[model samples]
Target: MSGSKKTYDTDTVVFGAGTAVIAAAIAAAKEGQETYLIEINNQIGGVMAASPGMMLGAGYPMKTSIGGFFKDYVQRMYNHTPPLARRRLSTLENLGEEVVYDPDYAIFL
Candidate 1:
């Protein structure tokens, strides 16, 4: 059933295009590595695209923003023309900060 095997010359090959996977790909690319991302779905985001009203708990129990790619992503959402996201206190006690964003806008971003 299979024919020729295609090979990719990449320093990093990340399977899946989930939030974490995307971040890893981006980080690898940023480090001057030739990174490739493979996703089963047509879209980039995995659970993020599937689940509506999904909240990203960036600054959870520690109550501090986790810097790096996540921080940049949050900043981008905040800086969007229409402001795609907003910080909120988690409903659960001591859960710390969470980001609630428009799923459509999130996908676009």
Candidate 2:
């Protein structure tokens, strides 16, 4: 063993940079905790970064849905998309608790 390896002393250590993990890290940091988000992949969003047609299902009433960071990300995508596409997504949203967004934007966000 050598002293080359570094160490981190954090109040919260998130093991992934996926949507949920990222949200957890954000929440921890917001609570004034020192947080570390570790991601094995070179990119973030996990499968979502590649899955362009990915839509997250909340499996509940939209009124009681948990927004958090994920919601903010989705809202950001809405601004990136065109009006016609926004209209389409709006139609879909009327039917279910899901959000459709571009994958490339996911990585950028």
Candidate 3:
């Protein structure tokens, strides 16, 4: 293992490690597919991570919905121990459900 770079062989390779890509990779792997996620940046979340905060608003009034990884993420945020993280679930602040999280948490999720 001198100069050769590590390699991964997967049945499915999802580019980018954004929320959507992560969700897709999870879905694919769940279906028994060998899945891999690749991102150029050392950090994940892409533009979402760089932004100050993220908005999880409803596009269709109360009808807007989320499932899979998204739902799980919201649940995780809701369960976060810090008051700040918990506050993100409720404080509208002229905006709806905006979450301010540490960028390092992106990889954790």
Candidate 4:
């Protein structure tokens, strides 16, 4: 780390960790700005620690030709996750409805 160019009281400093803070760091780093994302916890993801699995918001997304950071992230998930990992499950236990998946996420725990 070079101390010559560095300065205190940064242009951007996001406290608390989670997807939001991580996103902020990515945005700042992509923008070529000096940024710092602080997390009280030792790990990066906060709520995601409790709630695993991809966010199903907007449903199965329509594929796009042009890719960005977020798109690339999702693409990595889709590609890296094996087909065998995709299993359906009964949701009557907790979700109060039918659900599908490779296995109940709780199985790991």
Q: How accurate is candidate 1 locally (lDDT)?
A: 0.77
Regions of model 3 farther than 4 Å from truth: 1-9, 61-63, 87-95
- Over the stretch 1-68, how does candidate 3's per-residue lDDT look in tens digits? 69979877779999998877888999999899998888897778776566656666646365334556
For all candidates in order, the CA lDDT equals: 0.77, 0.66, 0.68, 0.49
Instruction: Name the runs in model 1 displaced over 4 angstroms.
Output: 52-61
Best by TM-score: 1
lDDT of 4 by residue, 1-109 (tens): 8667955776688898665577677788789888888777666565544544433322324422234554444444445435212323333333221212232332221
What is every candidate's alpha-carbon RMSD to the true fold? 2.3, 3.9, 4.0, 8.3
Q: Report the lDDT tens digits of candidate 1 across residue range 1-109.
A: 6998988777999999988899999999999999988898778777776664434554355667558987898789889988888887777766566777876678677
* Per-residue lDDT of model 2, residues 8-59, tens digit only: 7779999988877888998999999999998987888877776654434435
Q: Sorted by TM-score, highest first, which candidate order results?
A: 1, 2, 3, 4
TM-score of each: 0.83, 0.70, 0.67, 0.52
C-alpha displacement of 74 in model 4, angstroms? 1.8
Which has the greatest lDDT?
A: 1
**3 versus 4: better lDDT goes to:** 3
